[model samples]
Target chain A: MAVEILKENYAGKVLSMTIGVGDRAVTVGGATALPFHSFEGEVGNRPLIAYEVLDTVPEDPPASLQEELESVWDDPVKWAKYCQDEQGARAIALRLVSTDPDGQDASPESAAETVKKVLDAIDIPLVILGCFKEAKDGPVLKAAADAARGCNCLIGKAQEENYKTIAAAATANGHKLIAFSNLDFNLAKQINILLSQADFDINNIVTDPTASALGYGLEYTYSVIERIRAAGLMQNDAMMQPPMFLDLSSVVWKVKEVKASEEDLPEWGDRTERAVHWEAATATSLLMAGAEIMVMTSPRAIQTVEKTIDQLMA
Target chain B: MLLIGERINVITKAQRAAMEARDPKPIQEIAKAQVEAGATMLDINIGPAEDDGPQLMDWIVKTVQEVVQVPLCLDTTNLDAIRAGLKAHNNEWGKPMINSTSGETVRLNTFMPVAAEFQCDIIGLCLSGSGLPADANERCAIAVDIMGKAAEVGLPIENIHLDPLVLMLNGNQEQAMHCINAVEMFQTLNDPPMKTVVGLSNIANTAPMEMKGILTAVFYKMLVDAGLSGAIIDTLEKDFMEVVRTGDPASVYPAEHVEKTMKVMRGEIMYAHSFLEV
Candidate 1:
């Protein structure tokens, strides 16, 4: 199929970037053409997948993912290092889950330690996520952002309430920001506008329109993302123009269908294979719907999704 | 100044009949003609009818979007219709504008979410449940309230266009002056400047026939002087609209001098002058 060159002016232009001290570099912009339409226009770079590594062990990761990270799950730096050094991940996303108020309530210092260790161990780009608890994660993300200063990492889950402080930290430290809004295009545009008003360079902003698992409102998420992309490319709305990031791993890992044992549902296939396919399928769906960056957990799923992207690009 | 075409409404009998028949071809023609006549947006108002409002609105929105590239302001009192219109034409190039709502807490609570849900701009009226204020300060307060509600909903202030309720001048002679002051006050009070508009003909409503020309000219000048960005008026009247487009010069005497030099272009006026000379 011939690709439609959607945005001729902005095609292939890296959104923006900041030079890291050593190898912890990141490029935020690059859309030579629409997502996965490489035949018509230049898709300068393939979509980058960040391997998800959490501060604490995931309560119930799928067996496939758990087995792969077993040797390094105890140490975040080792885990991040293994994903990059061995697994060929383009980026590493460290989820600061400990900062959740209901969870371990980890301090900013701990989050910062994990960030520093990951940045030191791997030269690839870094994406530092918060625990989704605005109050607790706000300060924790700020500390991590400060610790990773000058590395030009992407820090967020910077929601509506706490975006001001998080955006300020990223702007001050020369890093990118992830503006997350619930599954609504208006909220996404509104947050982006608010952040831009606060003097954050829009080029450094990435939108996260909150994804859902395959059987759980995935169609709604797809429509919202597609609308956002259409508004950006067709309407030329600056607020909705940022490349999107779909946090696929979190959405897939938490679902019952992905985590349940095969014996629990006799008709279902192998639990490990089913879960990995679930993550891969969800990530692939998002890619088709214009997700520029995706974060996933299972190594096998990442490989499968990457191969699919390659075929689509070809 | 953006001229939002306001012809497509169910309030008029003709429009209601057209909608009842589900004949959007006439609506599409009206929209096309309005765009040709320089309408920046087509304000679609499908009022409360016995028929399904949302379904009708959806049909109109889709038909209009399919025909024209210009955007449509989904104007309706029915929230369901607004939602349907938004859903049907989700990916249009222009951001649709929600016709209006007063700053009353009830209205804001109801409409702000819809505006946020559809990612469209909205027109805010400078009046509340207490009713339209008589003075500028109170009107500005209402504008501020509406803007505050929009901000609370995380909608940018720029997305709001404030309508400083344009009251007629026939009954109250000082109404036009008060409306002008209200517009100025609202402009000064808004943080991220908002576009101000008024229904141009509203100021002349119920005025004497001979008084309409004078009233429209004076009100147009006053509103323009007070920084009105747009007005809803009949754009078909080329002469009146030309005067408006030309900024309503202080003296037509000097305009006559310029018009005579460009006589061939000024067909009717020049022909009348030639007849008088003959």
Candidate 2:
């Protein structure tokens, strides 16, 4: 089957962003073409994957992941260190999950402490995320941003509700911010615009157009990220040019396909292997759709994605 | 809508006094006010000052720039004044606007090179060697000629704005529709559509002062729907400007049917431009 290659000549380049300060600092974006259409324009930095670490310990981890993290699962700092060193992760994302008002309601001070310890342990860049609660996330993320100061870490989840405080914190501390908006590409651009309107530098902002898990409306996220990349590259739309973050773990983990037991359906293969493959598949799809940074939890999936990236760059 | 505020002109009796005194205060005040109300460019017309045109214009440019950094439209009949104004412009905000040139062969050599040299945005009038053509097709023929001359000077075609001059409805009803026709015709002359602009207030020139608002609202809506891109408008006229704002959501959208219909019906917003307020 002979298929003609359709190429697009785009007018703009995505904003090149570098997170972290020194040798381990990673750079993403600066691509002028569609994600991997190197046949036409340019794709500068390769996509990066960051391992997830929670401020509060997880109540339950799958047996496959549990056995690997037996020593560090209870402590975010040690878990972050383990991912950076032993797991050979590229970056570590510190999720302030306990800061949700409905959850453990962890103090901002404790989250800050967790951030400091984790920053100290990892040589790779750090990504500090917050609970979905807008009001609670601002103080918690602001504390985390302050703690990770000078590490050149990425701090955010700056939704419309809390972008001002988070933007202020990021600017004051000299860190990168992640502007989050529900899957609409325009909303993502609008939130970034609002942040810039408040005098925040757009170059330091990353967009999160809301990720979706594999087999669970992933196409929506896939299309939006593709549109965002096209808008930035083809329309010269500066508002949409910020590097995108497709945080993959939470959304991919909670889905049924990644959790269903093999015993329930004998024709299906091993459940653990299926879940890891699911993570790898979803991450790669988004990466190809123009996500520059992603967060995931599995070591095996990281290997799969690393191999995938090698083939893609080839 | 690409709105160019038309209030800073020296034609008005109040403005002439301020310019004559070299007072930057009132011009600054108008600049700030127009920007606040969302005028993208402020048209600076120093009317009929050929003797002191250059000196007066250079002064006004500095005066307006002192307060607001917004781009200024250099409106004048004097070529030397344009040169003086361009010299005085800082361009920190953006390119200065050449408030106009026409297809008239006699004026092209004078204005086009000035525009090309300074790379100012040029608003090209549809009037040719003989002056305002009888019909829309003739206007576009002149527009095509203007575009050719502009291209010869290496000015990007996109920067050219074509104003197919508006005529008063009271004297010639045929030319009223003809003006709107020219706007539509001019837009089709290029791939990216040459921008259509109009001195919006001129269409109501002979209208009774009380009726100017209604006349402008009705015809301005027609020109806008016919593909007017920019307008030299009084941003101070809130109702008329609002009508321009909501006239067409955008080109991809058909001219807003309901609002256009309402303005024609003389609905609630129709009185929005009435003389009672003035």
Candidate 3:
């Protein structure tokens, strides 16, 4: 007897979304099937990985990053250009960590100026992420969104505590918005619903279920992404249909495995490769789980994920 | 979307035997399994238990409730069975719902009053003494009558879920679009909005076994897009559940299969044994 191969027939599709303008504008999502199940349906575009660029040098920069691009780490414009021109990054995610009141406490005007500088240096799409301090992000993102207006950049990370100002800013500036929820399917859906209810165009909205690095609650984040994707495609839920965005760098860099030196744990092999693998592994796993776009650190890790995505798409 | 598990109906041989023997084990096991498989409600169907409906209905209601606490929909042509089920129902989950009443005057009169007295949700089939309405407008006409009659009986219009009635696609292909249109019409019927549901699997009846899954899932997407509120479906099918939960069939199913299903549903191509094979 011949054994039959069973296949799933999904009724819904993830919204294929495009960010930026002109030739460098990248489109993600629009999956007709689960990630890389192209034998059954259309998988539209390959996942886009954006290199993470910080507005200010981190207090604890990863050694791998320090060894590679120590020259441009302090300058956002040089850093973005290095990623775009040298590393061949598909997109750039500029984290305005300096704007947090608890951190460098840079003013919104300065953040906007930095955004203009970065936009001028790179032709690829830019994703502007705010210092997640709810109270501070509104004004900072509002200024940044206004500065990037008509560039069609993706302005993010509006959470429940402070979505109104950020969503309004993104809408007013004609930029895409990323609605962030704390690793729960219902919360993710609710934020998108709230955004759409406020007259923000549903198509331009991207969902962020919040990413966690490998071995640190990544499974929970993975499940939420799968559920969000399934709800968008299988349940045809309009609120959950937006392509997903995962921020992997922030969580990946903080974990002990990425930070521990080779001297401290000689059995774990080289510190630099170990850290790069940690970031690459996390990104690869989430790609399988339906992350349409991701923000990643470690140039080596981004290259590994890019090659993996090419093979998977093939 | 509301999913009422269709597995417990007595038309199936195993369930009919279980209901006849008054054995609660098989029936309760199925009930527990369906709830675990993601059914928010279950249809307890006794197919015209003309001889002992009242006793069986009461027994089954109490029996199924012992295992699962989800809401139940009492399904039968026997009027006494519906009353018996309600009388024995435990509302820890929710009040029991009537499986159906039609636009036929006698059925509307008999069940609407019972539905109102017990304050239960009811499925109002858009059908009459003459049989299923020919098109969406005719179905809407029957729906209006059913709504008006429910009002006259003091039943809340909100409690009535209008079913536009799905027909087998092989014989009645055009009725599929009419049913979808009717669901869209039913959604705009009232201010707070009336609910609409369908027997989702009915559209695939008599289709090849291989084709049933794709047909049901694709049509389900259409119904959901039309603003359907619920469906009585084979909730045990994992892919079907995925379709119901995600509401997108185009992404999971093969491109050719989805397109073929669409062509058949739209009546662009006649349904045949080779429809999917081609």
- Return the top candidate by lDDT: 3
Of candidate 1 chain B, the 10-residue stretch with the lowest lDDT total is B268-277
Best by TM-score: 2
Question: What lDDT score belongs to each candidate, Candidate 1 first?
Answer: 0.75, 0.81, 0.88
Clash number for each model: 4, 0, 22
For candidate 2, the per-residue lDDT at A4 reads: 90
lDDT of 3 by residue, B144-217 (tens): 99999989989999999999999988657779999999999987889888998898889888776887888999
Scored against the native two-chain complex, candidate 3 gets a DockQ of: 0.02
lDDT for B110 in candidate 2 is 83
**Model 2 per-residue lDDT tens digits across residues A146-235:** 888888888889998899999999988989999998887656766877888888988999999889988898999998888777767876
| Docking level of model 3 | incorrect
lDDT over C-alpha atoms for residue B78 of model 2? 89
Off by over 4 Å in 1: A1-28, B1-278
What DockQ does each candidate score versus the true complex, computed on alpha carbons?
A: 0.02, 0.01, 0.02
Task: Sort all candidates by TM-score, best to worst.
Answer: 2, 3, 1
How would you encode candidate 1's per-residue C-alpha lDDT over A98-158 as one tens digit per residue?
8888978888998899899889888888899999888876798889989998888888988
